[model samples]
Target: MRVVRPVLGAPSWVSLIAGDLDVAQRFYGELLGWDFEHGPERLGPYVSVLADGVPVAGISGVAISAGTGVGWTPFFGVKDAHEAARRGVDRGGTIGVGPVSIDAGRIVIARDPDGASFGLWQGRAAGVGDPPRQTGVPDWIELRTADAFKAALFYGEVLDWDAAERCEVFYEHERVVLRVDGRSVAALRGLDRPASEDAPVETPRWQISFAAPDVDRAAARAVELGGRVVRRPMDTPYGRTTELADVEGGLFSLITPKARPSATAGE
Candidate 1:
């Protein structure tokens, strides 16, 4: 796989905090055909997830018992971790962890105003690379919040995304699209989720979608591997998509990307 470095404020890495590292590894390894390698020691017994021999994500077993829920968090690259964390807080977000030092770089865990958790990293992101969107690597990352416009403002300020030189922001189909150097990287969608007296308020979160060659087969395999299909496979712009919860109930989606035209066509 070709390694491509990410730009400032772009997504750099993703990770899941699982209760049992062994079970998480086994489940994903079998389900997504992924390989694993030991992550930086400073991160403490974590495993970097590799899809087609390229690092795509990480799974850490250290914080599950410390009240951290099992969920996937996307990390964004930052030129300055301290400034990013401060900007997030200034923009109505909250910092849960630090701009602390690690072997690979400095990191900060924070949540947007809507309570969507995300991370900020300042360093030469080692595991960030350009791997073809496949069954294991993330194909898309989205933030589902109550107001996309409001959320966009918060992120734009925190990430300094308004820089005309490298980034572009626009709205489409009632959602805000974030593009880095002409390529759509992520989106923010406003959702109307009504809460009943009995139903608890749901927190906004960044959703990660992994690619699948066959969505239906992948959903079935998830069930066989002790996962639950939250949403049956259905056609969408990203191709047939299915929402799933891992063995530990960490939610993610599977998307079969739409095929592109062959480059040699019309030759």
Candidate 2:
């Protein structure tokens, strides 16, 4: 019998917290050509960004927390935010924040069974689709967890996504692919190195990767703009990636593909 496959879902939107909103705006705007759409300045110090007039993501000023640093939060598109949150709770997850409205969408923040936090967006105006390739904004979301299997199962059941495939890649170790419908939405992988003094144990945080036509150029721009390069750009089997941190210590990465299919191409 021939096996039928489900349609892959598109990634909707992603967000991050800025330690310094003004500096982040200037840096991302200059680097990615992102246009900042200031919401009511009184919206408790949050700013939304638009790409080609579409709401791509938002950033809010975050205070220093116990475990989390100033980092990006990526949201997956769901049909109903409340339902997803409820399912997450049923599956041994906890709600971190809202089933509440922010701008055009209703979002609920929840943690998986293994304590990985994620956002579910029932978008009113912004849908989970592929990000613009030309812009140097978030194009992919990856989860680095201690237990990839449990994380995969928790998200699969909670979000109604399916585990697409499990493949071992030499550069990043083994990766378990998850799909919403048939579309590759996110990846779950185990850490290569244990947390130590230099490599502190970062909490289960989402690493948001910005698309760069040239990883070297993006890394250079990040350094020139007062952002520090945490990991120098290097070619891996998957892609060319370099870790970076803003002047205020928010961490993220710039990635240019070396061999993989274009993430925006629905691969």
Query: What Cα-based lDDT does every candidate model obtain?
Result: 0.78, 0.64
- Candidate 1 lDDT, 1-267, residue by residue in tens: 112233576776788888889999999999999899986754556888888777778888866665788889988877789998998998889998898997667889999998999988788633322345667778778898988899989988888886634567887657798765455657899764555677665568998888889989999999999999977899965467898999999999888877521122110
Which candidate comes out best when scored by lDDT?
1
**Candidate 2 weakest ten by summed lDDT:** 1-10
The alpha-carbon deviation from the true structure for residue 244 of candidate 1, after best TM-score superposition, in angstroms, is 0.6
Query: What C-alpha lDDT, on a 0 to 100 scale, does residue 255 get in candidate 2?
Result: 77
lDDT of 2 at 70: 67
Determine the backbone clash count of candidate 2.
6
How many pairs collide in each candidate, listed in order?
0, 6
